[model samples]
Target: MNTVTRPRILVVGAGFAGVECVRRLERKLSPDEADVTLVTPFAYQLYLPLLPQVASGVLTPQSIAVSLRRSKKYRTRIIPGGAIGVDLKSKVCVIRTITDQIVNEPYDYIVLAPGSITRTFDIPGLTEHAFGMKTLAEAAYVRDHVISQLDLADASQDPAERASRLQFVVVGGGYAGTETAACLQRLTHAAVKRYPRLDPGLIKWHLIDIAPKLMPELGEKLGSSAQEILRRRGIEISLGVSIAKAGPEEVTFTDGRVIPTRTLIWTAGVVASPLIATLGAETVKGRLVVAPEMNLPGDDGVFALGDSAAVPDLAKGDDSAMCPPTAQHALRQGKHVADNVIATLRGQARKPYVHKDLGLVVDLGGTDAVSKPLGIELRGLPAQAVARGYHWSALRTNVAKTRVMTNWLLNAVAGDDFVRTGFQARKAARLKDFEYTDAYLTPEQVRAHVEGTARQE
Candidate 1:
């Protein structure tokens, strides 16, 4: 009797979707049934919603970056790399390892969940001067950069330079932008106390957005409530406006206002991962289009979810409607896709992904929050509780939950250190410095690489 080989499963990314998928697969599939492999640049699922807290120095980076290998029993073989391209025909994934090595990983089944990158426009000086809040490093760098500005402003005798260093401009009014602006404003507010020489009133925060309203998805009442809270905290909420051009020392708004500032934090939006383009598949708004079952239409053994795929929105009951790229959808889709993969392996039927909106939560630091959970509008401390509670429960591990809770407690009681980690001292960490948007293969290059790998095999 010959022993049958277990199916090899390859999962890309360690985000909410990919991590949840792998966890579900590990729980449901026995060692003899499947061999799981995960490819990611990092070995942790970055709890992204709490990234504002990280930037604000309320929580450490490690607390939100949940470790993938926390359990010794987890059987998935971890490959530390980012997938640059995938060939559906050849069933090979082209990966660029962290050590600058090229690897072609073949798989019996593939899950593409390679999340998203910071959405940027072609504004002249945007990428060159602005800072981003998308990744762990960017968050840390922002924290340090903000503090450094205070130090520089305090040391400088020139009034104009001091004013420029003290002013901070944050672009975008969505969840990330709003939270980032709010949290960092609080950080600066708190830090200025330590810098007695710096005028507290001079530390101005401007939150600008081209949209008519801030966090419009939060609805009228909740959105207005949030805007009010931010305004009360002294954040200059500039609606119906955006940056016309960004320079190192100043940003010119479309409304013809040039604000002098050394800091420009861009959190406008996110586009699907560039890896999606390499597949040469159908994409709606840069996201790969997948069936309701999270599988590629007419393409066997290929599945996509998270920010990369435009999964059908069955909950909306519309054929053309697709699920929004959110952590809420990503978490559920990850589990559903894993179940569908297991069903395919066992020769069983697959199920479609269907989930309703849970709600939105925005933590604005220091007991200020607005949330709409299960259709109930909450503000102030109650809303803060709801926001923190939702994020706490959503944490993947008990360790992460404990760390975050402890940090919250400490922040409530002890307050922040206001210490600069000196990340900016060694390098000029700008928007383009953090993300490698150029590090992807063209569709033609993907084909050529896949063909070459096939010949070698």
Candidate 2:
């Protein structure tokens, strides 16, 4: 007996958009309809918003890592690798696996959700010295590094060295940067009590950004409230400022002020994955240009979403305005794209992806927070409740929700143990370490690869 060949569907990345897309595809598509495969560097979908909490030891890494295998219902083939290049003409994707093995995958339909990398500048020593808060490993390593700094500071006899170790610089005023500075500052603040020789006053955290307003999207009033909250916690908020250079021991500001510090956390911004460029498709500001329906323009089988796609904001009734790269947008887009993909397979008409702005929430650690849920501005405890409540509800699986809730409750009741896993000991990772931005092949290389494979067969 002969079996029918199923349509191969390839999904890239395992972030919010990718994971949601795959899950939805598994649920909606019949067993014989399509063969789903996911290509990602990791096996889990990372809940990125709570990454700051993971770094500050408020939550364990496992709490935020939602395993893709958690579902017993889905049998999606998981490719533990990253797609380096895609030959859209041939419908082939070039992937580099974790073991440094290269392979080609052919698909009838492909979803590009490779997500974004931490955006760095041309400043000298930026990639060599700056720490990023974009990945689970980076977050864990940062926590260890921060704790180690305090330990080293207390042991040092030289006041200069101690001062430098105690001072920390975070370059970004966005939600990630602000929350990181706030959460880590609180960690150091609480940990200083254990060190008799270290003065709590010496622990300084400076949050800076080139933008004039910190999180200007929050509006002036709410942004001001967030700034005030951080300021009251002894965090120095510097607006309209940025790092000119970064060194192993110090960092210089764009305004020419030199600050001695052992730590430089860079959360400035993120750019779409370099994989998008391999397709040689039209892009808007480095993100692949896609229709409001989340399909690549002129390509019915190709879909792009998440941080890597410049999806038009149809909700605003503007063609130029694109959806912001937020978790909420990505999640909704994932579901929408899955429906569209299924629709295409069934030869049905597809609908556009349109979602209204559900507002923003910035958790400034502890009891401090600001939220604008449903256009209603809130601050302090009420805001914190709303923020946590929203995040808790957004978690994909029941296990993930339980772990996050348990971590939060445990941290609140017993406090952090301040233990380092030592996995990152003696291995300092910079901005370029986690983000393999330059790993993608050029369009010519992609064509050559696909053509070579075709000839070999």
Candidate 1 has a TM-score of 0.98
lDDT of 1: 0.93
lDDT of each: 0.93, 0.93
Q: In candidate 1, where is summed lDDT lowest over 10 consecutive residues?
A: 420-429
| Model 1: colliding residue pairs | none
For model 1, residues 195-224, the per-residue Cα lDDT tens digits are: 989999999999999899999999999999
- How much is 48 displaced in model 1, in angstroms? 0.2
Point out the worst 10-residue segment of candidate 2 by lDDT. 418-427
TM-scores, in order shown? 0.98, 0.99
